[model samples]
Target: MFSIVVISNATMVPDEAAIIQQLFEDGLEVFHLRKPEADEQAVRLLIEAIPAVYHNRIAMHGFFHLMEEYKIHRWHFREEHRQETTKEEMMRLKNKGYTLSTSVHDLPTVQRLTSLFSYVFFSPVFDSISKHHYKGVAADDFYLEAEQKPVPVYALGGVDARNIRSAMAMNFDGAALLGTIWKEPANAVENFKLCKQNVQTY
Candidate 1:
């Protein structure tokens, strides 16, 4: 089954907590808190704003402090963040009970990451506003690469209610969205519902 994962970009102008709550209410399985530029204080405020009940359902990306404080065991780490880190370091993080996820833009990177993390996000399968000028990989190409991957692969970038069915038809384990959800926070619930419906039908 495909799932909806929201990528909360801290750089967006409007605060999306209310929409996030609605998504939570509507049954979003995982919320990836991915505000890379936000300081520790800002991230804490965001984390605290979320209701306690949703804490276990949501996962913080790159916020180790939140993990320690809230007992969140899932993390999404970027390639650059793990560049100098060794396998021992990754094992240490895993030993702490964190289910680590990472992003891979190419096959070589995907090969290197399969043994290190539980899942991988192979992105830009479609044009993305979050990463301007990033030419996306063709859906067929992505599928071909992902079919060989040892870990489950998620299709990220430019995913929304409109194209979610197509994403599922391509056999992605799941899909992740950033601007599509954050851009219209007030409509988040409906958007997520629509995407979920499409995913089911596809």
Candidate 2:
């Protein structure tokens, strides 16, 4: 099954929370709460808006405490965040029942995460307007790296309704969207449906 991950940004906060909830209700499989600057209160507020049934389906980036509080099972951590926590620490986290995921910019990093994570995110397969200086990795490069991965690799960055089919054709487990959904709250539900339809067609 293909998954749709909704990536959050700081600029769009509680205002966008209800739209996010709508996406989840509309069949968005995963939601990645990535507001690096958002405080604990902001996170709590957003979670509260989302129904309890979907809590476990949501993934938060680097908020272990919140995960425990919300009973969230999926968690994502960037390489830099992984560096702060040791492998043994990660193992302990896994023992406590967190489905760990991490980001990779290259093949070597992908290789390193094989044993540690259940999924890896290979980003920037296309230029992303939401992020500055994020010159994406070529599609061919991503395919080569994904071929060697032991776990599922999600294609992130610059994914939208237009090019999602291409990403799916490459055998990505799924694609993540940030700007495409958050930039236009009113269209989020329909946009997500269109993206999912394209994925199904491919």
Candidate 3:
């Protein structure tokens, strides 16, 4: 198992591209650019900020129109965005060689969606570090269902270096962190190192 982190859901961080570039340098396998409220130009500027070489590892969360113009090879759909898409639309995206992923908050949803995505973000495996009110579900709830799914189920929410190994041991194919990474963007590389170090423990 490995690890991933969703970028902050808010506006761009200072020296954002540099920080992201460093994450890539630190061996980040996938970079999720989730800008929930960014306008087209804002998204454009952010993508432009990163090097072209890293585009393939980027998974987009919004501003899909940019996909046509960028070389980004992966996409992420929240449940709301997912409701608007059809199987045919998904197949079309796959035909283009693009990969798809989405977020689900529960075990049943992950089971139902097992065949639809390259992977799914099964969230709040622990209480959210970014959203204090969002307490986590039992990790066993994730392990039990994920063990049966062919598709990868990434443990999202509250994962950090401390518990990443436990998450992998619980049957998550990988871990996805938000607050742990965003909490200190300047230290993101060292932070990612911490998670990977835990992963290596397994």
Candidate closest to the true structure, highest TM-score: 3
Task: Flag clash pairs in model 2.
Answer: none
Alpha-carbon RMSD, each predicted model: 2.1, 2.0, 1.8
What would the per-residue lDDT of candidate 1 be over residues 59-102, giving only the tens digit for each residue? 66666766878767787778787776778988988887778888
Kindly list the per-residue Cα lDDT of model 2 for residues 54-153, writing each as its tens digit: 8988888856687877889897888798878888988987888888888878767776664668777888777784777887776553454454777787
Error of 2 at 62 (Å): 3.0
Cα displacement (angstroms), candidate 2, residue 1, comes to 3.2
lDDT for every model?
0.76, 0.78, 0.80
Question: Which consecutive 10 residues in model 2 have the weakest lDDT in total?
Answer: 138-147
The digit string of per-residue lDDT tens for model 3 on 72-156 reads 9898999888878998898888888889999888777777774658988887788888888998886454454435666888888
Q: Which 10 successive residues of model 3 have the least lDDT summed?
A: 139-148
Candidate with better lDDT, 2 vs 3: 3
TM-score of each: 0.89, 0.90, 0.93
The most accurate candidate by lDDT is 3
Model 1 ranges with Cα > 4 A deviation: 12-15, 139-142, 145-147
Candidate 3's C-alpha runs over 4 A off are 3-5, 139-142, 145-147
Q: In candidate 3, how many clashes are counted?
A: 0
lDDT of 3: 0.80
